[model samples]
Target: MGIKAFLSEPLARYIVAQQHEWIAASREVQEKWRTGLVQKAMNTQFGKDHFFKDIHSYVDFKSAVPVSDYEDLKGYISKIKEGEENILWPGKPLYFAKTSGTTSGTKYIPISKDSISNHINSARNAILTYIAETGKAQFLDNKLIFLSGSPVLTETGGVLTGRLSGISNHHVPAYLRANQLPSYETNCIEDWETKLDKIIDETIDQPMSLISGIPPWVQMYFDRIIARTGKKIKDVFPEFSLFIYGGVNFEPYRAKLFESIGKPIDSIELYPASEGFFAYQDSQDEEGLLLLLDTGIFYEFIPTENFFDENPKRLSIGEVEIGKNYAMIINNNAGLWGYSLGDTIRFVSTNPYRVLVTGRIKHFISAFGEHVIGEEIEKALRYGMERHPEVEVVEFTVAPMVAPEQGGLPYHEWLVEFATLPNNMEQFVQDVDRRLTELNVYYDDLIKGSILRQLVLKPLRKNSFIDYMRASGKLGGQNKVPRLSNDRKIADELTKINQ
Candidate 1:
């Protein structure tokens, strides 16, 4: 066998073997995992305060370590930022991943050597798992293009801060360089539009097999590629068969992205955040990502319905039930302890532990007691798509049209940018409204009682979201518009931009 082929087989075998172990692991086996990770960090300052040294079981771990947010850990992280060693983890962090400052300003998350390895291995395992499942080993033959963040990193208080993609780009195996596109030098360019132009010029004629990024930015790249070459994306990269995406739900952007492709191609949704590689799309037949149970990260779940209680109960992986919204708490080798990543998820399957990312904890819309999240918006849109196959909705965001001082009930304002609007736009809105009511009982009650006005649909010019993001200085690389917001803040901003 050739060298690449030889390398691929063993990795695929290893991942498949691990998958079997994960699926068969008993509740006791998984709980022991939580204990083991806690024990490893027991020597750190965080561990000492939380009495990790005295912990013996999952019950002790949860009761001792309080669920924390970024602010709660900021003091300890500040010490690490000032060159403190062994505060959160042993020795100093090699790098700090700067998060997109959507809710909590830009956060500098420490990335230890162990955490870096976890990210890389998890990514490889994902690909190998795909190979084991689909037998598509041909994917390794062509270039893989990642439309990533600017690699030009900056130092802050002895820590390097940059986008997660830029921060992790250098750690990838050098052997894979031959098949990776957009030279390192080009990836460092600050201006996204300029960088995209350079990337299109460099990759439009290459033997590309994969394109991976957040969907909106990927759509922008696809749009440019089509415009530049005057041919379909499939024609430009015939080997381009798989799209790996994360940092946002793929459902809303899927139809818009497919409009750029000449033929059908498979896609995978990843659940990776700046903290670590959490989960990934393991099976094409499945709707949710298989939670990474064995990685350096340990997980706890706090049901969203009871999140604000004086003391919310935290459940371990083995105890979590399917169909409940839980805010995630992660403890990782990256020195994060009980850190509330602000993301929410629901267990779609419990036997093997698969989860669907529901949305961000701070990103839901509950303005009128109708709690609508990112997942609901996506599901509602998909339902609308099922009813109208011809309509190609490109991008959208929703905000509440709160009751004006003049009077009348409040309703939802949907700003949609479509590649082609449905022939019956009014029916399209009705379909969305009907689906949303079906998904949210509170919403159904409101509409039935006439307590809220019917939903309003506003068709935006194509690339309106793109234009808004670019104007806000967050046009690319894991940056996404919040799909649902409680207030009119973002909606008013976008409305003004088009004017």
Candidate 2:
């Protein structure tokens, strides 16, 4: 069946019809956008009106507005606390998705009712398409396990203010709804700790066919299941057909996960985020085709090389080139216009518009001033792994650390979990270092003498990432473990056990 036929007929028609409306709306917005009207309005509203007096004052005013980091929205957040209308949205937002902030404790991003509805529709469509591709729709009559965040409600006047996940849960299909175990919503437990226990208890004996969530949480659930039942995931759910995951890269956990489940590689990888359900792996071999939720948002790509340059160019959906890294900026109906999500991605093709996510823009190491990005690290790691047939990396993260103890130059410390601990751990580390040096000239210079001390390796258990996530209270649900920690403390804490 074609992509359209794969969707539920009524839903397909609704989405297509909505797409037409969006296209018209987008054209109107883009016209105004090109004229810098949106930026003018936003600046007047957001700033005290003194800044951005004229649109031409800021470069790229049409495609770019003055950047608003998480700190810039504090006043709006305070307004939310005071029960006043916030400037983040055009109208009263239906709900807020609490996301982590670097400096701010937590950021409550507004999601309008319309945006929530769009998210729901996009997610459902992704699932349907996935089922069609895998031919697993036939087997989905059995129960599905969703490892998601518990619905958190803001307490107001002795009552819950907004039950976020509960609203989404209500929209689940009637047939499949009953089969779903008690989520963070139905459980009265407010603490995530208690909610996780409840989720584990509910699924221990259930016949779950499909598992979905951020990878670390799913791994934690699998760990808990094994601990409780003394059986591997394959033993617990022999009929399992799907392992849907998103929110973080799954490459590091692949070997251990596949070994435990005894499932084919195709059983894993699904990409969905809080903003919207973006994409999913269409076929076993094909990298994810980003089915533009054209109805949800208008997409824009800013080339990675241009991000730091004074005069940068942006590409609309049609204009983007394949194999070039770009940062995603979206003008979504959710009230975020020209917002940079800090993720770097590359298009694989444009016909159906397939893309591969490279990594986070902010998550990179440059101890020796080489400006090594996550893409480079992934490439280097993969190359090293391919060369060494005996070793399989289970979990790995690289961090730049001061090396006073090891000769006083900054160094990249690798915390690696291998299938088998290498007899010559130093040799393995040196080999990886050599591979990385070959990839970048600066790395070679740093390694030889100037800036870097030495490549260090700390071996970990196969399930170390899973353990780390569980320990951090991020396991299960929406929260994901970051592959690279810019801060040294988190990275140090992660390496402690291995050391």
Q: Which of the numbered candidates is closest to the native, going by highest TM-score?
A: 1
Q: Can you tell me which runs of candidate 1 are displaced by over 4 Å?
A: 1-3, 405-407
Cα-lDDT of candidate 2: 0.62
Cα lDDT tens digits, model 2, 144-184, are 77666555466432223443444466567765676677653
Report the Cα lDDT for residue 3, model 1.
Answer: 68
Clashing pairs in 2: 148-477, 217-476
Q: lDDT tens digits, residues 1-499, model 1?
A: 3366557877798878978786788465557667776777888888888888888877787778788888888898889988887888887887888885655687888988778877878887888888777877676777888889987788866777787888768766777778888999889888889999999988988989888888888888999988888888988899899999898877777776887887888878888888888888889898799888777778889999878788998888877998999999988887788788889999999877899998988787788899888888889888888788887877888898887556788888889888888888889889999999999999989889988877888889867887888888888777888888888888998898778
Q: In order, what lDDT does every prediction score?
A: 0.83, 0.62
| TM-score of each model, paired residue for residue | 0.96, 0.81
